[model samples]
Target: MNYNSPHKGMTLIVKTITRITVGLILLYGIYITLHGHVSPGGGFAGGVIIALSFIHLMLAFGKEEALRRLPKPLVSLFESLGAILFFTIAILGFVGGYFFLDWLNKGEPFKLFSAGSILLSNIAIAIKVSFGLFGIFLVLVLLKFTPKK
Candidate 1:
């Protein structure tokens, strides 16, 4: 209910630096998510990091501002779209005369853009999980404050 706190009005310099840092973290999370299949990170890890960035913003700016920036419906739509895209790519392999095909370009590992299908799937999962969690958080926060008739 009361998402705002007395500590919300923090110093401007700290807030500015934090906002920049969060932006960087979110970008890094996206990079990790997209490159997961070819590297150390993966969907879950990157998704959590992405969610954490938003959570930090929520803590800094309050739930109302965060919700305004990222509405629940948009998050849900993105989550659903990501899942659909991932599934569609997976199913394409079956229709392409192969079952469980990797669909990768078979380039050298550790390259900038290698491990095609796995990379794509990882991206999809990252988007789905991140937005899904955000949506859940929005629901829980709203429900906590929603007035019962």
Candidate 2:
């Protein structure tokens, strides 16, 4: 629960560099998530990048600081919301009388915001994965720092 860890020894410059790297990674994650439907990147890849951002922050600073940036409750809410959104989208296809059908408008290919259903799915997945990984990471960090009984 302590933000100031006694184990930290990295110089200010190193910490600054690390923070910059983490910020870049987070931006990349958002890019991947947004462009998932049009390119090779997707929810999973974007989610991993998002999680890596937090991981990098945790490594550079500490668990407490990372948690401050991304609280457990918020992450958990996002995870649940993402799951619900994904399921709702999937259900829409079924309600439309097609199994796993792509309901959203599939616009021109190679466009930034084309492929509506695919984009929606990718976004849902990204949110789910990012929050899920963050939750897991938070738990692991807590366990690692907990004092032995």
Candidate 3:
């Protein structure tokens, strides 16, 4: 847990477990996001999963390594871009004379390719949620926790 030390964060056993689980966690996040339209899990939930995976990395390896993988600036950019993309899609629905309308072709039901706007919206939301949460975590991590003198 000493950030300055060569052996920074957790024990080797925890680090090894994290390395094994991280990819699975990320993949599960993607799966949840993609299946949002049909299932109960949606953009926000999936995004939380995704963010947790990164946060797990930070917890196991330390902030330095996690930040190296995903810099704050890049995460900020992704968050903003997600918002812009979400808004753009909403605005584009105006073309159909409705807000958040399904202007795009709606493919067959229950299939992966179905639910036109929902899919895109889920993606946008996932991006926003993941990066936004991660950014908050980073900000918290950077705070110097000094006890009262």
Compare the candidates by lDDT and give the number of the best one: 3
Q: What does candidate 3's lDDT look like per residue over 20-128, in tens digits?
A: 9999999999999999999889999999999999999999998788888899899999999999999999999999998888888899999988988999999999999
The order of the candidates by lDDT, greatest first, is 3, 2, 1
Q: Write the residue-wise lDDT of candidate 1 on 1-149 in tens digits.
A: 33334455345565677777989989989988987876789987898789888877876776777888898888889999989988887887885578657765767787867876887888888888888887777787677555789
The TM-score, computed over Cα atoms with residue i paired to residue i, of candidate 1 is: 0.82
Worst 10 residues of 3 by lDDT: 1-10
Query: Which stretches of model 2 miss by more than 4 angstroms?
Result: 1-10, 144-149
RMSD of each: 4.3, 3.2, 2.7
Model 1 weakest 10-residue run by lDDT? 1-10
Q: List the residue pairs that clash in candidate 1.
A: none
Best by TM-score: 3
Candidate 1 has an lDDT of 0.78
All candidates' TM-scores? 0.82, 0.84, 0.93
Q: Residue 129 in model 3: shift from native, Å?
A: 0.4
